[model samples]
Target chain A: MEISYRDMITVLHGMGFGVLFMLAFSGAIGVIYATAVVGPHWPRSKWDNAMFRFYLISMAALAWLATISGAYIIYPWYRAVPPAGTADLSTYPRALLLSNPHTAGWHDVGMEWKEHIAWFTPIAMTMVAYVFIKYGPRLALHRQMRNAVLGFTAVAFFSTAVAGLFGAFLNKYAPVRGGPDIVLMREN
Target chain B: MSVEQQPTGSGAAAILAAGMGSLALGVFAFAGDAVPALGRAFTFWQPTGALSGVTITAIAVWLISWFVLSRRWASRDVRLGPVNAAAFAMLAAALLLTFPPVMDALQGK
Candidate 1:
């Protein structure tokens, strides 16, 4: 079936919005798991550790949401009046991909936003600093709590990296493996 | 200080293992035939972009760090101190540099 630019744009927008919702949904679910369902059963040390990490997770989630939101807006603007085809040819695949409508679109927008999620390392780092400021120097801080913090941080770090590859996979075969530009140029 | 103390080496080793595992998974996800199916867990659609070497490196680092920190062997327990702090800062800087505002200035975005 032929897809219109408008229709393709809609699908792209829907996918982008879906990811945003996923981020929100996952963030909320994680918090709920940490709080209502499992918070009470957790040891005090774990609770404190989790609470500390939770703030960081929340911050990182917001950062991701913001980036995706930014792309969702900026991308359209970029597409609407993209750089004129100087017809200049070069080797920068990344640059080429960015300028090419065939490669760059709402789908690309979604993929690119996912790609940038790794940017939250600073937030995570800042979070670590916050933990140190609030809980550090107190040598007697619960060992279990400390370990829990370490574990949570480790998990968060692990996930960030894992998510990167996951994002890559989606980008590599978007709209089906090696599919033509039919999806991009298809009319409604 | 106690015998029950976690060997720092083990932690680092664990991190390393995690990194390797992720790398392998990524290789399959990006290059292997089953990539399409595996990629579905993360997204409804598959990715068509190139695999990122930088991201792979980051995954390796995390894995190595975990392996070193979580190991039970002769403890090399490195504290999540200045080093990790510094690393995080650098990653953040790289991220900000890629933002559209920054890209615009550099590429005239």
Candidate 2:
């Protein structure tokens, strides 16, 4: 069973947008935590606290889901296709799918780094969630604790940004040159 | 330090969970790159090392650290603050382990 290039493109594009959304939410947690409170003063109100909680949990979930989904789809596809140099000519289509043919710049290097580090984003995000959920209202009253949570969220935001950037870079450079760009085997 | 809510058993659990999550990610990446490579090496099958060797190494680094660090403070309750160091280490080690593969891709070797 194979897919058309159009469908492949669509899947990649959809994954990209999903990751962007994940980044936005992850960043939102850090931004909100910073200016909103420094402890002592506590949350502005119950409403504000509720909203903050919502964003924190959402960021955690979104980042993990996006990270897992992207890893699931992209890495496996690369694995399935043997490199043209390593495999026979009959396996050209697999090798020609995502990776670039020539090493002009940081294209491949940047992506490999991105894929590896991106794994930890979910773990970091989980810490963000753990700190927020277990501590609860106390986080608003204690300045030091608040800062710790802030640091975690900030880290989360940074990692997600890195992942998103590398993912886009890889996508832009995918498709081997001087080879069949799309090998359609009927779209299902 | 003055806070009443300091040091609890739960912190270690949370930190451990994070470490495990990192381990899972690393292992998955390794498996992704390894399976293919293994098949190609052994049989006519063009196995492309489904698991990434880099990721496996990263996981080993993480697991060892988790064991060593937990032992370092096994008697005392793990605080979130101190555990941050472990988290950071795990994150850094993961990225560092994967550097070679990325370089290979960039060099097109």
Candidate 3:
């Protein structure tokens, strides 16, 4: 079946949003697992270590992919419009993707901070995964480094959570998509 | 050393694996956007298609990393602080420089 740009765009957005949610979920698990493994006499299993590292590496990588696809959908809208908060309310009350601001606010300013903040997702997650692996066996031994890793992981996790919130919000409202010379969708 | 004390593989392998994994994601996902020809090159449906691509890449990275890291271990304890740190630093640098915004800035007058 031929897919409209709307379907494709929506699907891509959902893909990124869903994957970001997964990333956050996996990241939370990672931090928990890492924390659990740390401390005296904690049972240490090599395979378990491998499993943890695998989770981190794979999730981080997948996050990058999702973000890339998400950007693919967003970039055109991002560039085609004027700066956020500067849009002409009368002519274009919302950004390119909003038929109206009430329902699908995410298509407008809802996504503004998300678009920019989303950049940090892959960067931070990749680092978090690396730290977990490099210090796989030593995390508990070094308190400061352990805390640092936890902090960074939290940030990455938080970032993914934010992306997910925007996604869920945007998707929930099923907002009208609009842009230069376009009005793909709008809720009455 | 006990099995518990020794991690299954060398830290270096895991480091490289993460980097390779991230790169795989970058190639598969970002290419479609940055280069229109590449995106159109394959008729991948959104979401599902994209998920499949990333899954393949993630599995490949895991297998390759495990194999390489295990082989490198070769019955010795390997503390990966310096080497892994170096690899992580390199990947971070590459990500920083190649990220879209930075790339755009570099190209713009």
- On DockQ, the candidate that comes out on top is 2
| Backbone clash count for every predicted candidate, in the order shown | 43, 22, 3
lDDT of 3 at A19: 62
After superposing the true interface residues, what Cα RMSD does each candidate give? Answer: 10.1, 5.5, 8.0
Using lDDT as the measure, name the better of candidate 1 and candidate 2: 2
DockQ of each: 0.07, 0.25, 0.06
For residues A1-188, write the lDDT of model 3, one tens digit per residue: 34445445656655655565463565455554555465622326777778777877776777777676665654443334455676553323234346464644464344543543454466556656775766665656545444445544554566566766776675455432453343456657
B-chain TM-score, every candidate?
A: 0.38, 0.41, 0.53
Task: Give lDDT: candidate 1, residue A98.
Answer: 62
The order by descending DockQ is 2, 1, 3
Model 2 residue runs over 4 Å out of place are: A1-36, A82-94, A97-101, A104-108, A140-148, A175-188, B1-8, B19-81, B101-109
Q: Which stretches of candidate 3 lie over 4 Å from their true place?
A: A1-9, A12-43, A77-108, A171-188, B1-109
* TM-score, candidate 2, first chain: 0.65
A11-117 per-residue lDDT for model 1 (tens digits): 44335533443344444334323533343333246555555456555545544453343334323322232245646323222444565687654334444434444
Score each candidate by Cα lDDT: 0.39, 0.52, 0.52
